[model samples]
Target: MAFGTVARASKRFQAFDLLATLVVVIRHDGTIVFANSALEDALGTSRRTLEGAALGNFFVDAGTLRTAIDGARTNDFATLRYEAQLRRGTQEPLPVQVTLAQTDRKAELLLEMSPQEQQVRQDREVRLLDQAQANKELIRNLAHEIKNPLGGIRGAAQLLQMEIESRDLIEYTQVIIHEADRLQSLVDRLLAPHRRPHVVGDVNIHEVCERVRSVLLAEFPHDLEVERDFDPSIPEFRGDREQLIQATLNIAHNAAQALAERRAAGDARITFRTRIARQVILNKQWWRLALELHVIDNGPGVPDSIKDRIFYPLVSGREGGTGLGLTLAQTFVQQHHGVIECDSVPGRTDFTILIPLP
Candidate 1:
């Protein structure tokens, strides 16, 4: 019996779908026999559609994958590894690392795809974590340093106002008091994230979405619309209710603000979408399932100038923005051991919060 014939007779392809890495099983002639969910997602299609399709159909530059599969079938190497680009449906081709190996069963060759950008994202995550921790310490000390003297300045200004006979001089003292109060408020926001510890319990993800939706609609009832696309099957998980609310609200509010032009066009929208993710890796740990809450906006995307620094403390993309909203939202989500990521383009921006679910 030929090795290819024996491989075609094997029946364990389903096990490959549970893996986190994108996987595809192919025949000796470059026909795709099976594709795991990860691979299907990469190809932007269903398994049924992917099966029987030519493996080279999805790669713009198929040279590397073609040679790798040939070597895997011929046993040139135990594994053939190379980099290739995967073409998506009407989207940019994705850069990925391809690994090909022969299966124990006959001529069945297994191909694994890992996004090349995953490494870059991981490196960026590490740096962000480090930056976040350092920012926390700086905020704690600076809030105190500014907060302690702020009250004294305000009190002295008030005392000066009381002692001044000239009404014009009294107005100057009032200005001093008002500016001091503004600074005090800013200091309070800087210290906001550290004000409380996690109050964890079973939290219904939908409830959080609804609450934020109501709040946003009440605030922007003119032309803004908050839409919900929820998956009811998503189970309750342990999280801080108030923190989740605040974090989600910050994102939604920012989206609404960005929709100023869209609002004028009478089509501003913010979508609160919840879905379940399986076999996910987050913050360098594996989870069976995770909660994916996406705050999607149909507005001008994040400005390119401050796109990368949007989460940094005191960095605001809008006029009169304190720039503390996203920072606090990130801090709260991090407290729940989740990570938030944003992807933006011209008219769409998605702020996705991933929290591991039990």
Candidate 2:
């Protein structure tokens, strides 16, 4: 193929560059005509290097791709689908589901590669989003139901306390009122997200991080250290500034509390890292660009018992924890069309928030 022809072919397939899945256009002879950006990143090679290379060579078992290509060329199948390990330059081979289809041009074929790990992650994200939506409805309805009787109970207890003459009887009424008030507060928190209107405006993510960092330091000034590694190039986007600040603060505060042992030893540390992820997938949607905000801590990782259910309402790993911090944080981020994920191991815990950017 001439150089001009290859450049035009690549330009025509530029739309594939925005996809998170790796894609390449190959000739009937198995020579790659075009490799998208995602494919380049996965192979740890440049498009210029990938083009004109044999597509079958990138797979662990070259025969598998060769056979698939032959099948496609002969019109033996509408589409060939199989799982294979893909070779890369800088890392271990990645397990990917390969899909091959014929393009309109007789000499060209379209091949897509979806990483198995990424597919699983996308499935999990979908499930998490579904569960979050259901939880929000359940929480809002349940909270309202609890709220109605709670007010009556507190008012009745206050009246009963005033009528009681014996100090012991009065103390019991006071206890009833206190317990009712506590329940009311809990119910209020459960409904808080529903009550607040989503205020949208230009929001600088670094400012949100700075505000949260200030709060974390103020609350744990003695031993905790809050560090920032921000990407100044991240432009402001439309979001609720206060909500983002509160969401970030909640995560940071939770980290600080988890670092109790380390804090006493005067070596507790937390970091706020921000970067731009390209051709990303979040909540099962492909994004050309997204902001990746990570809140990392050096405390003992999340408990094994609650690892999966940490975001569920009323779930907590720490004693005396309200268990609503993460739930609220998730709710706030979701309002901005984003998702929060936690990756934790011994000595390190990272909470990543992904939101699409314009």
Candidate 3:
């Protein structure tokens, strides 16, 4: 009977080893006692190497680990959230999240990591929120200030054209009228998305990519190339179709413009790649499946000065740029519960959009 009981207990222990999340058990004196299989898999290390080593040894900073251990001793479980560099042997340090907990017989630590892509998504969301709010306010004020005077300017130009006897003077009046009409059109474009009704439906991300691809190819027939790498297994998501198209088009347009200079030089390429990232956390919410779409280009990257504030309303690196392209892109994506981010370096630039799966 005792032998059977021991076997059952051992089986349960093995089950825990198999199913447990990444965790490491350590003695009260800070010696590693045991590490679950998940931890081993995550860190690429074995229990033999981890045992008897202080938990702090794995952390880039010794003081942070010590403080967490001290807090755990008093509170039974303590979480310390600071940036740490994780290393195993000669490999480069990896950024990780370290949480320490204390039990009656042993202490345990849990390490989690923030992927580079997800981190960028988060930063982009924050910027988008700020930019959208600012742009909303700006548009409201600008429209009120400009709309009333625009009609008068157009009427005055028409009146001046009728009275002017000289052909050159009439031509100048026509130019004024033309400029006023153009400004009105520009204002309408800026306000059109905001005023239109949102048409929500089930959207296949691949379809959006394909539409953007066709448009981009038609626009830059000889000067550029647009590539696609999609995962067909992903399901359709809930969003506004026209809004998504515009948002995607804005980003793709910027990529095309960036590559224009390179296109003239005979070295230009743009790629659209899509995949599903599992167990992703966005805006402090964990998602089971998030669609990741990457728009990459081979061109001069974003300038360093405006990199951080590229999503801010009216911020642009180009001289004639209105700087509303990315701001509008972010607003539309966020409206559909998505995020857009950019990372750029010399000769390579990547813009990533992540939206939750239905």
Candidate 4:
């Protein structure tokens, strides 16, 4: 693994291979001493070819990288950072954020390149996490406030009905009591996730999917079709089995409802897919391996108007819908340090759930 005058310490650089970012160690003359696995994959080239090549040549504008390398050689600054277009074999040049710094070994410089899109995705995930935390606080406070008055309203209605001598008047009191009871139920559901402790245990994702599938089939036996595309290689991880089942069932049920027209046409289809993702980032943390479970449906997709707001509590596209299904699903998945994303168009809607795996 030796290149130029750099030391043969390939074993020392093995840690970089685990990183999602591309890293390369170069000599003072700008010849690559070592290239990480990430870099090799990004360039669509092997490490053997990358190790001896000039790192600058891989960039769209080599001059920018050359200047940055020269600056690193001198005591110009502790580190240098900039945006650059990286060239790959035949693919379009990729936009990346580049960072250059000197290593302990004076003769070698460490350079890191991360795709700009990846950075944006990480930022989005962080924002989603922050937003979820805020939502939890808001729901807890709001539910408690609603719960106190709700009990009083229902109790008062019950007492009023007992005192009412006129049958018509008693009927009105009954309506009040019934409506209050409904509101109470809604409040309880709003507070349900917070009330229950997250029970963790070994969870086989396939089992979760199968449970949801059987339930869905039983409910829509005549029309809806539930399919499975599971990866046998995915191993079981520690999580709440009940929570996962409920989360998956919520998404699948929503899809089934959305497929109302397709069901009548006898072509409603919902797919449960599972796969393993490697070197993935979720909730601002990196996982060497992650589980990607997708719930895809062939139906009239989520309405474009409310697509973005679908995950928000009490937001629903369907009429008379409580809209808590997707919200609870998102909350349950987040409890496992995962996230759910929805991609919808007119014909296809995909809900992907990603969770870090051991």
TM-scores for all predictions: 0.76, 0.96, 0.77, 0.93
Ranking by lDDT: 2, 4, 1, 3
Q: Indicate which candidate wins on TM-score.
A: 2
Q: Give per-residue CA lDDT, model 1, range 255-282, as digits (tens).
A: 9999999999999999999999877777
Candidate 3: RMSD to truth: 5.3
lDDT by residue for model 3 (7-39), tens: 553354354364324456665556665665555
Query: Could you arrange the candidates by TM-score from highest to lowest?
Result: 2, 4, 3, 1
RMSD values for the candidates in order, in angstroms, are: 4.9, 1.4, 5.3, 2.0
- How many residue pairs clash per model? 0, 0, 0, 0
Q: By the lDDT metric, which is better: model 1 or model 4?
A: 4
lDDT, model 1, position 129: 77
Which regions of candidate 4 fall more than 4 Å away from where they truly are?
1-7
- Residue runs of model 2 more than 4 Å from their true location after superposition: none
lDDT of 2 at 134: 92
Q: Assess candidate 4 and give its lDDT.
A: 0.90
lDDT of 2 by residue, 1-358 (tens): 6789889988899999878999999998999999999989888899998898888889899998888989998999979899999998668999999999999887889999999999988888888899899999999889988988889988998988888799999989889988998898999899898899999999999999999988887888789999999999999999999999988988999999999999999989999999998877788778888899999999999999999998999999998988999999999998888889999998999999988998
Query: Which candidate would rank higher by TM-score, 1 or 4?
Result: 4
Poorly placed runs, candidate 3 (over 4 Å): 1-67, 74-83, 88-91, 97-124
Best by lDDT: 2
